[model samples]
Target: MHLTVLSRSPAIYTTRRLVEAARERGHRPRVVDPLEVELGLGERPALYHRHRRFPRTDVVVPRIGLSVTQYGLAVVNQFELLGVPSINGAKGIAASRNKMRCLQTLARKGVQVPNTVMASDASKLRQLVKHVGGVPVLVKLLSSSDKGGVMICETLESLEAALEAILGLGQNILVQQYLRGQDLRALVVGGRVVAAMRRRARVGRFARSLAQGAKFERAGLAPAQERAALETARIVGLDVCAVDLLDADGAPLVFEVNSSPGIRDAEEVCGVDVAAEVIAWAEARFEAPPRARATAARRVPREA
Candidate 1:
């Protein structure tokens, strides 16, 4: 099978690993920059990179970055229009990128998530804070990523200041009840939990994201935690994702579904060939063809 990876940088660890894994599995793989691709129109819609048109490939795996999400998803949508299936797809990526939408979808599916509230009116900021369980809450901007969007407010005064600062920038915000528990990231690939890890925040930090100097180690998820993680992924419509869960008072709650999760650290800690697993799944999916959407009730977990 001819596999193409949509990435800005082919030399990145994740991209390199995926290319290597595809080769190891006897599949031809190449990296294409979405920004460099041209989208063509008319009866025969086509995508071209440089001066050459995209060739027929079994599947496309988009390792899109948050910075280029809009254009990246546009490219992915073009591939779908040409009947080429993407590993994560455009809809899934869009859904996962919006923090509020992702959490709302999970909540609607009866999946437990952190108590969160989004409000546009500054007058309602206090009410929103109260609704999310008062001060010491989290005020996160929907547009930021890699822990840059999140803020921890310890008092009412601090919360008001944070809200003003965020709203002043013309960004939407979500207030969430702070969870003091384990920050576990469950890597779901091909509808299965391939690897899970716990992120321990550095001193004086609340956000335990990997980018925030968080220490990580391979961790095991409980039955409930595993179920929540997998279900969250399904609801978000991602074939591959990392579900962030906070163990709130012993109950696993969805933090966010990350469509393009960084796999380097997880790969090293879990001793799992995550990239290889992704390629194996893509190979099978290319042959079998994917359903329009995954059934929310069905258990899609496979042996890892």
Candidate 2:
């Protein structure tokens, strides 16, 4: 099999680990920056890598970061349309990437989520916040991307200011009831919750995600919370996902579902062979759909 991995840092731990494992497993693997793939508009969309012809690919593993998704998913989607397998399909990636959309889907799936309201209309801002309820409110950009752009406002003046700042981009802002308590980051792969960590803000931070400077340690969650993580991924149509849960009075609230979930945090804290496991899972999933052209080894199946 031949694999093309789309990631920003081919040298990064997770990328390197997965690439090496692919070679060890006797697959031809190429690491390509998705941005480098040129896209053109036409009757039939197409992609081309500059100065190089791409070999047939069996699957594309995307470690797409928020910075890259704008152009990255185009390439990944090309692979999908061309009948190449993707660890997480384009719709799954896009749905999970947008914070607001992710939560809406989770809620529709009967998953408990933070009381969230979205509004961009200057007239509706106050009404939206009222729906969320409380003096202190959290405002998150639906597309915060990095583990950031989330504002915790403790006063009415600050909350209003935060809402204005977030809405300045001309898109709706997600106003959520701030869940105050412990935080859980659950990494799920192959429809299973592989790891979970409890995080305490480093004295001043509000979110348990490392992006908030929270210190973390491995912790066990109630079976309900664990099930929530797995179900979130399943409902989101993901092969792998990072589901962030907030434990407020032992009830877990799904805050985020990340498709290109970071492996470093999960691996460092949980000691899981995340890269190897992801690669092996891809291999197993590939077998799920039988092939017309079969290769014993060292071959890229002709373009499907």
Candidate 3:
């Protein structure tokens, strides 16, 4: 089968492994920057290639990252319009990107979530904070989060300062009670947590995200943690996701979910083959819609 990876770069761990695995499975794997392609109003979205007609693709695996959400989802949506089967579609990406939507979805499913408030403007900030006990809180962007633009304010005064900075960035933020506990990231592939790890901030670090100088270790899970991760993905409408859970005062609170989750670090830390599991899922999903796939011999020539 011919599989196309709509990603911004080949250097990303998940993108490279999945593409290479597809090749090993006797399938044609092509990686392209979705930004390079323009969607045209036609039966097929014409890809602007250097030479020759672009090879027809079977499936699209979108490795969405901070830099690629704009052109990336547009490209993925075109494929869906053409009736292409993706493990996780553009709608799923959109749903997972919005932090509030995912949190609400999980909460509606009876998943424990940190108390949250969405303020359209700064006017409701003070009232919202009071309802949550006037304690320190965490404010995060609705989309594009990976420890990049999240703030933890330890006091109302600090919260106000943080809120001003966030709103100044021209993006709305979700204010939630900060769950004081260890952070764990559970990677769900094919509706299961294939890999999970406890991330800890090294001395003097704040956020437990690897980007924030956090270290990871294989975390032992209770049956409850396993159940929570799986359910979190289900309610969020994703075949693959990363569920961020925090234990707050002995109760686990679901904090975040990522449709396009990265597992290279978790896989290494947990001694698990999450990439292989992703390959298996793609193999199974692709099998059901064989007619939609390009055959092996339809490979893109290396020098054509």
The prediction achieving the highest TM-score against the true structure is 1
TM-scores of the models, in the given order?
0.85, 0.82, 0.82
- Name the lDDT value of residue 146 in candidate 2: 61
Local distance difference test, candidate 3: 0.70
Off by over 4 Å in 3: 43-52, 122-130, 133-136, 143-147, 154-164, 202-210, 289-304
Off by over 4 Å in 1: 121-127, 134-136, 145-147, 152-167, 205-210, 289-304
What is the alpha-carbon lDDT of model 2 when measured against the actual structure?
0.74
* Alpha-carbon deviation at 304 in model 3, angstroms: 8.1
lDDT of 2 by residue, 159-240 (tens): 5666556555765577777654466889888887888887665433232223565566888879999989989988988998
**Clash pairs for candidate 3:** none
Give model 3's TM-score versus the native structure.
Answer: 0.82
Writing each residue's lDDT as its tens digit, candidate 3 over 93-128 gives 888787887788778779998778877665566777
| Selected candidate, larger lDDT, 1 vs 2 | 1
Model 1 clashing residue pairs (backbone) = none
